[model samples]
Target: MDNKEYKEYTAADFLNDPDFLLWCLDPDKREDLFWSEFPANHPETFAEFRKAIQTVGSVRLNNFTLEEGEKAELYDSIMSDYRALCSRRRLLRRRLFALAAAAVVAAGVVVPALLGVFRPPTETDASPARASEIRLISGRQSEHIASESASIECAPSGEVRINGRKIASAKPARMNRLVVPEGKRADITLSDGSRVWINSGSVFTFPAAFGEGERRVSIEGELYIDVTPDPERPFIVHNALFDTRVLGTSFDVNAYCDSNRPASVVLVHGAVEITTGDGEQVQLESNDMFSLKAGNYTVVKVDPSQYVSWKDGLFTFSSGTLERVIAQIAAYYRVEIVCDPDVRELCCSGKLVLFDDLSDTLDVLSDILPINCRIEQRPDGTRAVCVTARTN
Candidate 1:
């Protein structure tokens, strides 16, 4: 099916599609691409598409030739459960929105695709080449690191090494920038033993070693940091919009400058003081989530573990928006994902176990939400995934 026709498919439609069923049973790269791309293109039915895929996968119909009556019965049973689950979901959503709006305000896009019309190239159609790359810049020397992850370790001799190369000496201080692009992540331990876990699509810059009186690092995108206990010297996290200072604490900072996505600081433990560019300040104790968007800051109580779970490859979303979930998946997998504005606010609550394969994660997402996913390759050799509302 073409993108437009596929956009009209519902969960029942996908489940009844013979080609879709066979692809689910034994998929090739082409089939994989189509399925992965479907959810990104049709997020309104993204959750349902996932359910259909899962139902097909779980059913062992290929074992034997079934009679027409038997086939009908099996299909009926599956649909019954699917409908019940969807019903429960609708009810659950009502309860979740009441409680989660203040705590986990799900956030992220626009517009309609005219049938049979070719969309002229726009900014969104650009190749997602940066998704698969990571860049490191030290002084005037810049290099591309080819790995899914990067790590910096402090030697027993007080030397700071990145990916096993000693990047800094003991006495003096030097600044280094580490940019983990959309499809990768990194971990860095400073000379002072403070460790930072950088998420995908993030940029982190820190000094080689700690100097007297203070430690500071600036980041764009997302990071989970564990600041070593040093009562005399405080650690400060700097971003374009704000700065967070702490004595000895663990916190997560997500400050992506690409879009209006709010810069947020979620404290896992200890205490922090956040100061915005405009000098507005907010103090957060343990388990406080502070978000700043459009120069306004809001604080809410939340379970810090849910916010920082990405560091462990476990994504926990409690009534989170589909837009945010898709964005996280896109960054984690280094794929381009576009969601229709219509379905961006669809709330989903679930825990996803991430695998190295992007398709596997999408499958989990599809199973959790009524969404379809598909992959499309651009002329520039980069792949993009489009998500939209599934057709009735």
Candidate 2:
């Protein structure tokens, strides 16, 4: 839609536009810029624009495709509700205008007083946003799946379905892989009722349904899982260097390949047995963290918050080096951070709530430590943050 037309478009108009619907379905950078700018420039229609967005989000969450008649019925129902809400608001606006006019007339005031009584509204403020699209690999074909499009509700009577089609039941022919890239996270519920929180830059692969003997899945990077209990079928998690076996339990795994640090698993509840590729085995209890460095394995007691807090938008650092801390930040925000040699080895301890923009996080870090952060534009026209020690 052009700028002139966008200014006058109603919520229904936006919902009817094919381009607007496509943007709502698969929002990329260009769509994001257009919608963000549209609201800012035409704040009077911001509420209506948000209504359209929410309506589309609700519809997208249902995995099944609606027939033409069913789709029309759904649209009519939504529009009916919107019309009711708009009617109520319009009545309130009329009453307010009446009251303001009476007051202005009594005071013999016109322009300034009326403007003060009814000021123009501004665009709604939005918080920091991270696109969390999951990539699914089925056989040789791969597709990016939006969170709304991926179905999580368990199907009835031993059926495994995704996007309204049965993919597995009792026996499965192939394994399906799901990937969550950097700066994004995803929550998925397996066919067996187990829930998984896949962290950023992680890969997980599992069958569509459980087999007769065991339930098994493979992983790369990190995952926080709450496995379903079934003593008959043991649940197993396979990683690069080790395998975590359990019947029913909750645990966090960190095995990102890019990190120089040791790969570790932190158990929150129940019991888990970790077996290394080199024939080493260890059992962990609650609040236990098993770390694998090189070919050696070690177990230690640690606070579960330090390992599992990322699911709640937190980066907990307990006596960590500056290099490791910066690496974590770079991975979380999908940004490049170049740390000077002088400051890479500086050790620090703090809890960082990662709810704000990346720049805000860097500002807080610079304030607490003896470092300076600068955004540098590289020769390739890309930007990265360079962190150097503050010289006196």
Clashing pairs in 2: none
- Whole-model lDDT, candidate 1? 0.66
lDDT of 2 by residue, 70-117 (tens): 899869965865576576854433323222211110011122211111
lDDT of each residue in 1-392, candidate 1, tens digit only: 55346544544456445456546654568878987787787787777688766644433211235689989986996587567657685433432322222222222234343311112112221122344566666677666666455666754344666565565444336677777765456788877888899887677887766778688899877899999999889999998889999999999998765453567999998999998898877899999999988778899999987788777555677767776677677656656677666667777655554545576556545443445767788998767777656563
Cα error of candidate 2 at position 2, Å: 21
**TM-scores across all candidates?**
0.62, 0.57
Model 2 stretches with alpha carbons more than 4 Å out? 1-133, 146-173, 318-324, 333-336, 341-351, 355-372, 375-384, 389-392
Most accurate candidate by lDDT:
1
